[model samples]
Target: MKPTITITYCPKCGWLLRSSYMATELLTTFADELNGVLLKPAETAGEFCISIDGEPLVDRKAAGGFPEITALKRLVRDRVAPDKSLGHSDRVHAKPDSGKDEK
Candidate 1:
């Protein structure tokens, strides 16, 4: 069974747009893997979280910050489509060790 993704955002914190954006992005990105994406208004103030089938994926309070878009996608992709590629998101972001090459 495909997993249902849920984003709970704090209205007081003005995170509704953020939640909506994630829902849209996830829907488009994981159309083949996800069952549905739900945007829920959080009861607690300043609370924003993402869960898949009730399993916490992004716990803002616990993490002390929101998850980066790539990290969040990685988490979901790992659960839903482990074999799927996330294009640029899946690619490692790095630069060569310039000083080491210079001797």
Candidate 2:
């Protein structure tokens, strides 16, 4: 399953925004509030970026809506947690060091 919510931070201003929502609960709630416009599930992890005009509804300091945020947090956590059995290595290979003459 895809994430219900995706967020991004601005490198310059440190502002955060809602990037996407794919989870059924959040999207369905949002759609219902919008009078029945449904958001389809992604075929292969598509993006759902959006801009916030004002302050973020949720942030590092505190969660805004306790219930909704908690649900979404649980969903995101489940989606991002690495599977230990997968034995995935996160290391990146470094380029070979070049002699000064090669510069």
Candidate 3:
């Protein structure tokens, strides 16, 4: 199975500042973008600061400011699906139908 990873984000600015890519394939696909922002793998296990266009996007010390992160997680979760044939084992199963849950 593909490695399970966590992605953290700011809840205010709608910026996607941090993500974890445990799978080599996923990391390779996102390497360019991660490198563009200087996003590297976490070393210790604490929040890290992130910036874009010289503007502060994430303040790991502060409380609010990560709406961007939340939105990004939602977007990714809603958009990407794993390919089992490609040796990708991680799967986000579709939510089962429930009459009251239908929108």
Top of the candidates by lDDT = 1
Positional deviation of 8 in candidate 1, in angstroms? 0.6
Model 2: which ten-residue window has the lowest total lDDT?
82-91
Off by over 4 Å in 1: 96-98, 101-103
Q: Considering every candidate listed, which one attains the maximal TM-score?
A: 1
Each candidate's TM vs. the true structure? Answer: 0.91, 0.22, 0.26
Candidate 2, 28-56: lDDT as tens digits: 43432222212323222322222122223
lDDT of 3 by residue, 1-103 (tens): 2222333333343323334322233345433333232334444445545443334444555735333443433333333332212222333568977758546
Overall lDDT per candidate, in order of appearance:
0.91, 0.33, 0.38
Superposition TM-score, candidate 1 onto the true structure: 0.91
User: On a 0 to 1 TM-score scale, where does candidate 2 land against the true structure?
Assistant: 0.22
Model 2, residue 71: C-alpha shift (Å): 7.3
lDDT of 1 by residue, 15-96 (tens): 9888888888899999989999999998899999999999988999999998888888999999889999999999887896
